[model samples]
Target: MKAQSTAHRVSRTLLFHVFTAACGLLMVYPILWLAGSSLKGPSEIWRKVYSLFPEHPTLENYINGWKGFGGVSFTVYYRNSLVYTVLATAFTIVSSAVVAFGFARIRFKGKNFLFACMLVTMMIPPQILIIPQYIVFSKLGWVNTYLPLIVPRLFGQAFFIFMFVQFMRGIPLELDEAAQIDGCSRGRIFWSVHLPLMKPALFTGSIFSFYWTWNDFFAPLIYLNNPKRYTLSVALRSFSDPSGLTDWGAIFAMSFLSLIPVIVLFIAFQRFLVQGIATTGLKG
Candidate 1:
């Protein structure tokens, strides 16, 4: 009876793993198809639409895609995206941390009301503010520039601020008290103690901020008028002509290339992101 029961458990575990593997493959099939399509010859793509493997792989798509339109290569667009994303992410991290630290640790009048107001902002859709933002930026002559993309991040982003606040609250107050006892000013305590302990949360925020800014299409589409100023997302869109000529091969190639940075960033920081999110509301 013991041996029979053990065999039954083993069979159940095997079936469970088999089922999970099948589900994972189904979920990942689209991405795998995309990757495969990027390597296929344009003529073969539609013909072999159902096939997971490419029949005739070539580098021509990548080469042509990199050449780009209007005398601008993808290199320029990639550089612009990197600069825009990095600066925006940096500003978001610093600004969010500051605001969150204030709300989490500092005591002041009207703090709760202010924090509540900020929380309310999180519930509001960004689309509602786009018109007002556009008008304001246009009046300031900041349209068609990276300013429209980067400057808004300098102000505290409500979601990031809330995320940091939750993580900061998980940290013990004893550290702050000990720092104070050692003659550390609030700023010094924040800089020397809180910042170091907040690495996991900071990394989590950085990953999110980088991903959002890099993938942002609407803002860049609205603000940037010049082809030279286009980011990867916008440039990728230009490959499709509404007149019915679309370079599916080149689009697939560039789209695959555009995914590299995001994939690398996520892989490198996924550990910290998971840790930060898992521990967010837990007391240390």
Candidate 2:
């Protein structure tokens, strides 16, 4: 009876692992298909739509995709994307941290009210604000420039601020008092005491900011007009002609390349991302 029970438990564990592996493959199959299709010849891509392995794999798609349109290589678009994504992410981290610090640690008249108002902003859809934002940027002569993309991030993003605020509140108030006793000013306490402990949250926010800014197509589409100023997302779209002559192989090749940064960023900061989400408002 003991041997029979032990065998039964082993069988169940093996079944569970097999089921999990099957589910994981199901989710990852599309990405595998995309990678395979990117290497496929143009004709084979459509002809063998469901094929995971290409009959004729070639480097031509990547070579042609890198050549880009109108004598401009994809190098320029990649540079534009990096510049905007990095600067916007940096500004978002700094501004959101500052705003969150205020809301989390400071005590003053109307503080709660102000924080509540900021929370309300998060409820509003970004799509609704696009037209108004475009109008304002147009009036300011900021169209066709990175300013429209980078500048708004400096003002503070509500979602990041809220996340930071929650994380900050989880920290012990005793740290602030200890810093005060050591003759440290509020700013110094924030800089020296709180900031170090907030690294996980900051890293989490940075990952998100990087992904959103890097992948965002709609805002860049509205603000940027010159093909020279286009980011990777916009440039990728240009590869698809509305007249049904889309370069399927080139699109897939560029799409695969475009995913590299996001994938790298996630892998690098994955530890902090998990910790940040799990520990928010739970520490102390």
Candidate 3:
């Protein structure tokens, strides 16, 4: 009976692993297909729709995609994207951490009310704000500029602010008390005591901010008028020909290239993300 029961457990575990592996592969098949398609010749792309391997794999697609349009290359698009993403991510991280610290540690009049309002903003869809925001930015002569993309991030992102608040709450209040006993002012405490200890949460916020800003399309498209100022996301869209002359191979190649940075960043810092989220949720 003991041997039979052991065998039964082994069989179940094997089945579980097999099932999960199959499901994971299923989910990843599309990405695999895209990567495969990117290497195919333009004529062979549609010809071998179901095949994940190219009969004549070539780097020609990447070469063509990098050449870009209107005398601009993908290099310029990458630079524009990097600048926009890095600046926006930095602003979000700084603003969210500072605002979250106020909500988590400090006591101020109307603090609860203000925090509640920020929470409400999270519930509001960004699409609803676009029209009004465009109008405001237009009136301020901020249209067709990076200012429209980067300036708003200077204010706290409600989602990141909330995440930081939860994570900050997980830190023991004794740290603040101890810092005070050592003659540390509030600003000094934030700089020396809190900021260093908040690495996990900060890293998590940064990864998220980087991904969102890097992949953002709508805002850049709406604000940036000049082709020279276009980010990777916008540039990718410009690669499309509405008259049915689109370069599928080149498009797929660039799209695959765009995913690389995001994948690398996630793989490098995913541990911190998991830890921060787990600790924050438990503590909050």
Q: Model 3, stretches more than 4 Å misplaced?
A: 275-284
What clash pairs does model 1 have? Answer: none
lDDT of 3 by residue, 1-284 (tens): 99999999999999999999999999989989989999999889999798899999999999999998889999999999999999999999999999898999999999999999998997898899999999999999998789989989988898899998887888999999999999999888888988999887788889878988999999999999888999999988888757757888999999899888987887888787677557656321
Cα lDDT of model 1 by residue, 1-284, tens digit = 99999999999999999999999999978877878888889789899786878887898889988988889999999999999999999999999999899999999999999999998997898799999999999999998899989988899798889999988898999999999999999999999999999987888888888888899999999999898999999988886656657788888889989998987887887886567556654211
Candidate 2, 214: how far from true, in Å? 1.1
Q: What is each predicted model's overall lDDT from 0 to 1?
A: 0.88, 0.88, 0.89
TM-score of each: 0.93, 0.92, 0.92
lDDT of 3: 0.89
Instruction: Judge candidate 2 against the unseen true structure and give its global Cα lDDT, from 0 to 1.
Output: 0.88
> Pairing residues by index, what is the TM-score of model 2?
0.92
Clashes of each: 0, 0, 0
The full ranking of all candidates by TM-score, starting with the best, is 1, 3, 2
